[model samples]
Target: MTEFIPPGTCFLDLPSPFPMKRGGALHGARVAYETWGVLNASRDNAILIVTGLSPDAHAASNAGNREPGWWEPMLGPGKPIDSDRWFVICVNSLGSCKGSTGPASINPQTGHLYRLDFPDLSVEDGADAAAHVVRELGIERLACIIGNSMGGMTALAFLLRHPGLARSHINISGAARALPFSIAIRSLQREAIRLDPNWNHGQYDDERYPESGMRMARKLGVITYRSALEWDGRFGRVRLDSDRAEDDPFGLEFEVESYLEGHARRFVRRYDPNCYLYLSRSMDWFDVGEYCADRAGNPGDTDTRAGLAAIHVEKALAIGVQTDILFPLQQQEEIADGLRAGGAQSEFLPLPSPQGHDAFLVDIARFGPAVAGFLERL
Candidate 1:
């Protein structure tokens, strides 16, 4: 499985023998990243954007690649991210197949694909990789670090691991830790992939790819990415054509089912199942509470709260959609409350968005002003 390197994506060679958070190391590895705007003379205007699972480094259009990015609506000149005012850098997560070294990447020593042989990945490892990218670019500290969904977890780890490196943060639809429900959902997704006979223990090729497993996994994910409200509103219980339904009594009965099937099919071949497995498992293994074992001052505090309080950003904003089942609203509230306890000016905003965890990417009209106002005040 070849990694998907986006056009115009930039690469940063990681330090040789780059140690993984768990055991094992990569002799030669690289991170994929893309930047918008320019760092000012003072270099205090640099901002970093870490992504959720599956997103590439391209966050928006640039001279090198005119194609609009996944977050094209939110980032650009005068947009919410306001590239003209700040130098924005978005990095593909380290364990991702999007131009970053991951399971899909070839092993340097063996000259064979890493596949399942890749070292165990942790959210902290991604944080460390992102930090290296910023430092390599000559930015001593970032104005802000923005994260979405899994990237939210990475951002939290980034802050805790490297205190004072980013002055502020905007955590959108992110969480301090993976909730049990999220873990359960991801477990099912992974199970779907592994159970596919075509997976072949992560050794399948194009001719024998795990399409069924990948489709099931992606469909399950897509079902969770948005809310039931959005589903009902977008595609009620509308049935497909009677002729089509008659052809296969058990297949694609409703509009929603068709939507999911179409979406899953589109994604199955675009992303490597092995990479998906690695990234999904990493989220399950991450727990911010692990860092709070020794913090004694906050009596009766949960580890999640105590750990979040240990971080020291000067200012922060944690946003969550009201309908987000994955990465619920409470997590964002906890982030704000905990950051406030640590003396950062923090606030949590819960929007009445029906898009669920993916609302930050859509519903820009509602999210745009909130982000712009925060950045403007900075």
Candidate 2:
């Protein structure tokens, strides 16, 4: 009989040492995940949700809790995901600071926190870890694999690495590879953390964390995650306090500046700096074409189409936001085009939203229909 895991957060311990894409292996690695709905006897009505850079396993509320999730707007009994019909599983990324094994987790080898010592992680590693969870649940094939941002990259890696694992794929604001501009922005985020005095080369004491650097890094990230169009429309030279003097230089003069600071402060309290470094670097190194090349005769070639051509899913949907400067629409177009070239039924939907890359999270009205229609067709 299949072990019944209730609808809530749970941990899946890897039975043996987990191998990474780079050299070395992780011992006692565990993945934190959450499930919603019920799996039928066949265990085929399953959808795996891969999160972006910072989400935990809690994708949506369940019987145990009622709090809205990060993507709560699009996940519910009657939402786009419709938890009542499909068994949904969301896994926290491998190198995240959540309940999953990460830089903050204790290293079995030395009985100390891994910190920067955690083995380098890749998008493929995240996919492999999630795949293990699927097998542990006795699921042979997934109804669909859904991903956004970094999660989208993980979905691609899963499709390329473990062929026929999923019947369909839904990629939202994801890319085949990290672009140079995104890499450059993330590099600055990492630098901010490293430059902080409290960082101490990633060896700071528990009480003395690198809050300033992490805060600044998150501030920079917020800027890139949205577009200037959004800022102009939402905050548009609006002062935080009308009574404040226009010449006040020491305090936050604009509403946008305060907004960024608030988000950064909240992020620093929840995320570990080293884990951020590892996850960000992992995204920078990801290339679906590289994974595709491994199956081809010449592994060194940079043929993106050849890599995309390897995906054998029954259907695929790639959604892009017009103002998402981070991932951009061009990358989504390429993904759709490549999948079609590979003989898979593919559709590309471009959405116009001032929210930019984060439209999938907040602009549910536009994203929900597109996602729901695709899943319905599958």
Candidate 3:
């Protein structure tokens, strides 16, 4: 029912009737973005960042927004991303509720909310919109394009669909395709929202919003975002104080339970339910292997090798956490091997972090250095 647009964000008007990867098109649609540092005289020091499912374009505070951002620690002057040396640009995904055209946005022709009526969204569509933003800024080629989580898939799509767009890449906890387990998890999350009475087939207003469904969906995501090792070491059956305990038998009793409740509450209203369903299914439907030229021959078999080899880049780095379950370490390895097979000197680094899929966000010590080292060499 609400769209969260960060302060000091900039907008780029996409071409009229912007085509979607699946079907349909968007007219007078715009993408939200923010920038740091100055583009060098050569205009070649640009690095574009495509974010995960939920983050806004405000990756780190810029001149217009002084408040801290989601990746504040890793992106700033003298930080791993190092705004001092690079002209950094971060764009929110096209189909996200965060300041981007999505199910939460208005349809120009109908003068009403797009909601489920919005055209089918795909990760490749996000990639295409981001490419349009890049070209609009007069940049011919990017120095590097960084993608995290779902963004990693978008980055790969950007590279393949639009060859020679960037010279390097950094993929953190990203995958070439959605795994069955991940897809199942997202499927359950979507089901939770759909089953909620307040969801009303994506017709609910703020007063009757699907709070319970969103809470459950977010709780499921938080569970998978971190590893069991971290959960055990952090909350390990710790009981809440009697005063903090709930009267209901199934109410929050453990620190982990309280944490999930608080986390879900904070996120429920900030994102649109319909947007969540659209984006979640987008990831499930994404299969980079489908881009391989021999698709007709392969039939149901999916192999990403040929598709990965089709992308061109001078160098690449695929980072993964050993504890990651959603994307897993094998996906990072697959990306690295794929890039290397394409003749880009690529490397895969798997960190032994207990933070799981969210290691890139919290375990900055490892991810930060790896990212900085790769850029330094570039």
Instruction: Please report, in order, the local distance difference test score of every candidate based on alpha carbons.
Output: 0.91, 0.88, 0.92
Error of 3 at 172 (Å): 0.6
How high is the lDDT of residue 182 in model 3? 100
Which candidate would rank higher by lDDT, 1 or 2? 1
Provide the lowest-lDDT 10-residue window in model 2.
1-10
Q: After superposition, how far is residue 31 of candidate 3 from its true place, in Å?
A: 0.3
- Residues 11-34 of candidate 2: C-alpha lDDT, one tens digit per residue: 999756899999778999999898
By TM-score rank, best first, the candidates go: 3, 1, 2
lDDT of 3 by residue, 1-378 (tens): 567998899999999899998889999999999999989999999999998898999999889899999999999999999999999999999989998899999999999999989999999999999999999988999999999999999999999888998999999999998999999999999999999999999998999999999999999999999999999999999987765434676777788888899999999999899999999998998878887744457747777887788788999999999999899999999999999999999999999999999998999989899999999999
**Candidate 3 residue spans exceeding 4 A from truth:** 243-247, 293-301
Compute the lDDT of residue 173 as modeled in candidate 1.
92
lDDT of 3: 0.92
- List TM-score per model, in order: 0.97, 0.95, 0.97
Instruction: Please give the lDDT score at residue 257 for candidate 2.
Output: 86
In model 3, the Cα lDDT at residue 305 comes to: 80
Stretches off by above 4 angstroms in model 2 are 1-8, 242-250, 297-300
